[model samples]
Target chain A: QKEVEQDPGPLSVPEGAIVSLNCTYSNSAFQYFMWYRQYSRKGPELLMYTYSSGNKEDGRFTAQVDKSSKYISLFIRDSQPSDSATYLCAMTHLRGGFKTIFGAGTRLFVKA
Target chain B: EPEVTQTPSHQVTQMGQEVILRCVPISNHLYFYWYRQILGQKVEFLVSFYNNEISEKSEIFDDQFSVERPDGSNFTLKIRSTKLEDSAMYFCASTLSQGPPLHFGNGTRLTVT
Candidate 1:
């Protein structure tokens, strides 16, 4: 199985709508979860990162991790056109060294 | 905020030629990495560097692929003999420490013809 899996959604949402992006992993060892936003051909930009389970909030972005279920999610509230980008879920184990696995990003289009 | 910066936003070369992609990571960061992304695929890890040595590398990093921090401020990936399959966006990333949430550069689009 792929270490990390995510739905490659071209998810379209109206401005101010809430957006939820998620990913699941088979590795029980994953401890650090992160969300990265990529605009077109640009490189991935770190959006939010969480070290433990539950939720970590930064402004309109909230990142959640469930180590028990090996699941993670990123919730964007009151989304704006600027949020229209590909969102990729990434995670790594603190003990696994520097290799962080990335998910196939979900494309988001926030219509203004 | 200081950010990683990659040079020559785009590079095109012959399949058998050697190509070097360069990057300047955040001044205060100590760990550096190289990643690749095919046109429609997910970003994949290539290799990671710290303290002037390779700390970790994925299967994709083979004999043909090599990374070096030639100087204190520059990190580079050199493909010994590029193949058509080498065409992709090569990103250079770094973090203050060895872990998740890497800060990435805009990337260099390599086209091997």
Candidate 2:
């Protein structure tokens, strides 16, 4: 099985809609989880980061990590067209020299 | 806010030629990494550099690939002999330490003919 897995979703949504993105991992050693947003021809931009399990909120973004289930999620509240981008989930294990593993990004389109 | 910067936004090279991708990581940051993404593919980790040496690398990062921190601010990835499969978007990323999330540069699009 792949170490990290995420659905490559072209999930379309209307303005003001709530969007949910999720990923699952097979490694229990993963300690840091991150969410990144990428536009066409651009690099992944950091959106939210969480350490271990629990939820972290910043503005309209909320990141959740459930270590027991090896599941992670990112929620976007009141989404806008500007939020249209590919969302990538990444994680790293410090004991492994911080070699981050990235999931296949989920493409999102928030229509106006 | 501080950010990582990469030079020569695009590069085109022949299959047998050498190509050098350059980046300037955030000054206060300590860990530097090289990652690449083929068109419509997931980002793949290549190598990680810390304290002026390589800390980790992926299986895809073979002998043909190398990374260096020539100075306090510059981090670079060099491809000794390019291959057709080498064509991809290469990204440079850095973090202040082991625990923080990484900040990435815009990326350099490379095409090997």
Best by lDDT: 2
| Residue runs of model 1 more than 4 Å from their true location after superposition | none
- The TM-score obtained by model 2 is 0.98
What pairs collide in candidate 2?
none
Residues B1-113 of candidate 1 have per-residue lDDT tens digits of 89899988999999899999999999989989999999999999999888888888999999999988888899999999999999999999999987766999999999999
Give stretches of model 2 more than 4 Å off: none
TM-score of each candidate structure, all chains considered together: 0.98, 0.98
Cα lDDT for residue A80, model 1? Answer: 100
Q: For candidate 1, lDDT tens digit of each residue in A5-99? A: 99999999999999999999998978789999999989999998998698999999999999988999999999999999999999887663478
- The whole-model lDDT of each prediction reads 0.93, 0.93
DockQ for every model, please: 0.76, 0.80
lDDT of 1 at A66: 91
lDDT, candidate 2, B1-113, per-residue tens: 89899988999999999999999999999999999999999999998888888888999999999998888889999999999999999999998987657889999999999
